[model samples]
Target: MNCRRLNIINRNSQRLLFLVNQLLDFKKVEQNGFTVQFSRQNVTNLVTAVAERFAPSIEQMGGKLVVEQCERDIEADVDAEALTKLVSNLLNNARKYMKDRIVIACHADEGQGWFTISVSDNGVGISRDNQEKIFKPFFQVMDDNRESKGGTGLGLSIVQSVVEAHKGEIKVESSLGNGATFIVTLPLRQEGVTASAGNDIMSPAEDKGCSRAIDGGVNDVSRPVMLIVDDNEEMLQFITSNFNSDYEVVTAVNGKEALDKLSRHEVALIVSDWMMPVMNGVELCRAVRSNCNYSHIPFILLTAKTDNYSKIEGLNCGADAYVEKPFSVNYLEARIHNLVEMRKLLREKFSQTPLEPINTIAPNPVDDQFLTQLTNIIEENFSNPELSVDFLANRMGISRSGLYAKIKTLANVTPNELIQLTRLKKAAKLLAENKYRINEICYMVGFNSSSYFSKCFQRQFGIKPGEFTPHSL
Candidate 1:
C-alpha cells in the first residue's frame, strides 16, 4: 500500500463508481423511474463545482480546460443532481475526444426568462448525419484514425432525458474537423410560476376560490398569521384561499418582501417558494432561524425539489418540512398543521422543564445562544430580590414587551415565571445535595421569605420542601 498505488486505486475506484452510477441512472430512465427534482440553485456555482471536478483529470491528460467566469450569479429552478450528471457526462465525452482544449460557459436572458449552458471542445466534431443520431442509446461515432474510447454510450441519451424532464431543450452545433458545442437552454423558473414583480395579479381560473385580492400583508389580525411567499401570484392566491379561514394569511412576492411582512406581523409559520428574485427560500429559512425573534416559527419550503439531497439541505437550513411541486392541497395542509401543532407541543414540553437547555427546546443555535444568555443573566441575579422583568429586558438590550413576546413564544412562560423557575430549579439541586438546611437552601437560591419559597418550591416539584428527598428529584 504505497502512496502512489493507493492514490491510483482511489482514482480508479472513483471512476468505477461514477460509471456504475451512470448505468443505474440510465436504467432508472428506461424503467420510467427517473424524475427531475427541481430546486432553487445558483447556476454559476453548480456549473463551477461540477466542471471543476473534471478539470484536474482533463489537465492531467494534457488538455486545457476553461470554465468561463460569470459576471453575476444566475439562479434557476432546476434538478441539481440531474444537471450535475449532464455536465459531467458532456465533460467526460469531451475529455475522451478533445485534441487540446475544452470550454464551458453559462449565460442568462432576464427578458426571456431562460438560461443556456454550453460545453465546447476542440475534438473530432460529429458529422451532420451523426449529430442527429448521437443522443441515441449506445450510439458512438466510429472513426478509422482515432482510438476506441470506451464508454456505455448512454451519456448523451441521459443528458437529453434530463433536459426533456425539466421541460427544456438541448441542441448540438458541430461539423467535421470543427469543434462541437452542446447548448442546453432551461427556464429561469419552472413553467406555471411566472414572475409577479411585486404585483398581485391572478387569472380568472386562479380567482375561482378566492374572495379578495392578495395585498401582501396581514389579512385578519384576529387569526394566527401565516406568511406565504412565492414569486407566482397564482400560487400565493391558491394557498391564501385555502388557509384564509383559519389563518391570517400574509402574502409576499419574494423573500425580501416576506421578511418585511415578518417584521410587521407576528407570524406563526412560513410557507415559502425555493426560487425567487431578490432572495431564495433557503436563504430566507437561514435568516429566520438565525433571528431569535422568528426562530421558533415553523418553516416549510415549497419546492419542486423532491430529491433526498435537496430535502436534507432544506431541513438543515431549519425548514420544518419540504413540500414538492404539484403537491396535493390536502397533503400540504396536513404538513402545515402538523408542524404548527408540533411547535405548540414543544412549547408545552419546554414549559414543564423551564431549566432545561433552551437549545433542546428550539434546536437552533441562535435561539439557544439567546436563551442561554437570558438564563445566565437570571442565574447571576438570582440572589437580588430587585431583579424584575423590566431589568432583565434592559440588561438583554430589548424592550420589555419584546422580551415578553419572545420568552412566551419560545418557553411558553412569562419572563417573571422563568426567573422564579430558575431559582426553584437551583433550590431543588441544593436540596438533593443534602448539604444545606431547608431555610438555608431557600435563601441561597434568592428567596428572602422561607415560607413563601417552600410554597413555591412545593408547587413546582409537587411536594413539600421538608419532605423533599433525593429520590424525589
Candidate 2:
C-alpha cells in the first residue's frame, strides 16, 4: 500500500479509537462521573503526534498541516488518554470545517504556569455569532449542506469537558471568513500542592502570539502601565522611584488591591511581593491568570521565597518572571526590560508586504487567514474613503474590541493604524508610478482631504508627496 493510503488508515484508526473511548468515557461519566489520571506527559510531543494522525485527511482535502515546535518541551500533569482524546476531538472538529490548511503547536508560559496547544485552520472560518453556540451539545458551524451532518456534535463539547477535568480551559479564536483557532491550556506540576482539576488556575489562553518575521512588536507610546504590589512602604517607594521614569507605576499593598487597580487601568505588567499582609504574590498571580482581561499581563514576582518549591508554587500560580529579595536593583531592572520586550515582540503581526506573493508571518492558520482576508478587504475597498476599524470589523463579522485585540496581537498595530498603514502604502505606490496629481493620487487611495493626505504622506515617507515623481520616488 502507498504511504497516502497508510496515512488514511492511520487517520481512520485514530478517529475510530477516539469514538470508542468517547463511548467508554460517557459510560464512566454516567456511572462514576468524569475524572483524569494525572501523568507527566511532554505536551509538545503530544500535540505533534496528534496533528500527524490527521495529516492524511488534511492533505486529502487539498490542505497542508504544519506542526510548530516550541523553544522547549512543555510537560504537564495530565491524563494521557483524556488528553489524547481532547486533542483528537479538536482535530476532528477542525477537519470537519477546515479544508485548506491546519497548524498545531504547543508552548509553556512558565511564568504564568500555562502549557498551551493550539490547533488552527485555514478553511470556512467560524463567525463570532456561531462561536458562542459551537461548544454546546449539538451545535455546528452554519451550513445548509453540512450543518447538521458535521459529526455527533459532541466533539467540542467533549473537548471542553476534558479541559475542565484537567483544571484547564479552552477557547476559540475565529471570525466570519477568517479561520478558527482552538486553544487548550493545561496546568503543569507545582510542588507542595496536589494536582486537582478543580483548582482551575488558568487564563483564557491566547488573543496573543503574533510574529513580525524579522521585525517585532510595536512599543506602546503611552508610558505602559505597570502595577506594583508590596506591603513594605520603603520597598514600594524605592521601586517606584526607580521605575516611575520609564513606566506609569501604580502601587498596591496586596493582590486584592492590585486587582482593583487592574480593573480601573489597563496595566501592561505587574511586580509583587510573595509575602504580604492581605493577599500574597502567589495568590495575586493565580487571580490574575484566572481573569481573561488581565491574564495576558506580564507578572514579575519579587519576594524572599527563594526555595525550589516556592519558585514552583510562584510560577504555577501564573507568575511570568521571578525576582528574589536582597537582589540588585540593576538585576531586577534588566529582567523587567527583557520580559516586557519579549512580550512586545510576541504580539507583533506577520509581515506587512503586499498580497501578490503573500508571506504569512502569523504562527497559525486562523491568523494567516485573517491577515490574508484582511489584506484582500483593504485592496478590494482601496478606494473607499470610509475604510476604518468599524468598517473593517463589520466586514470581518467580529466586535470592535475583538477586532482590535486580534489585529493588535497579529499586526502590532491598532485598527486605525492598520487602516492608515494600508492607505499610505498604497498612496506611496501610486506616487512611485507618478501616474496622477498629488490630490488625485490621495483621493485615489481613499483620502478625502488633500491637506490631510499631504500631512500623512509626509509623516510616512519623510517628504511631501509632491517631492516624489517617478525618479524621486
Query: What lDDT would each prediction earn against the true structure?
Result: 0.78, 0.70
Candidate 2 regions with alpha-carbon error over 4 angstroms: 1-17, 144-146, 190-473
- How far is 122's C-alpha from truth in model 2 (Å)? 1.4
Q: Tens digits of per-residue lDDT for model 1 on 96-173?
A: 878899999999999999999999999888899989998998888876565458888889999999899888899999
Q: Ten residues in a row with the worst lDDT in model 1?
A: 209-218
List, in order, the clash count of every candidate structure. Answer: 0, 4
Q: Estimate each model's TM-score.
A: 0.51, 0.38
What shift in Å separates residue 334 of candidate 1 from its native position after superposition?
2.8
Pairs of residues clashing in candidate 1: none
Worst 10 residues of 2 by lDDT: 205-214
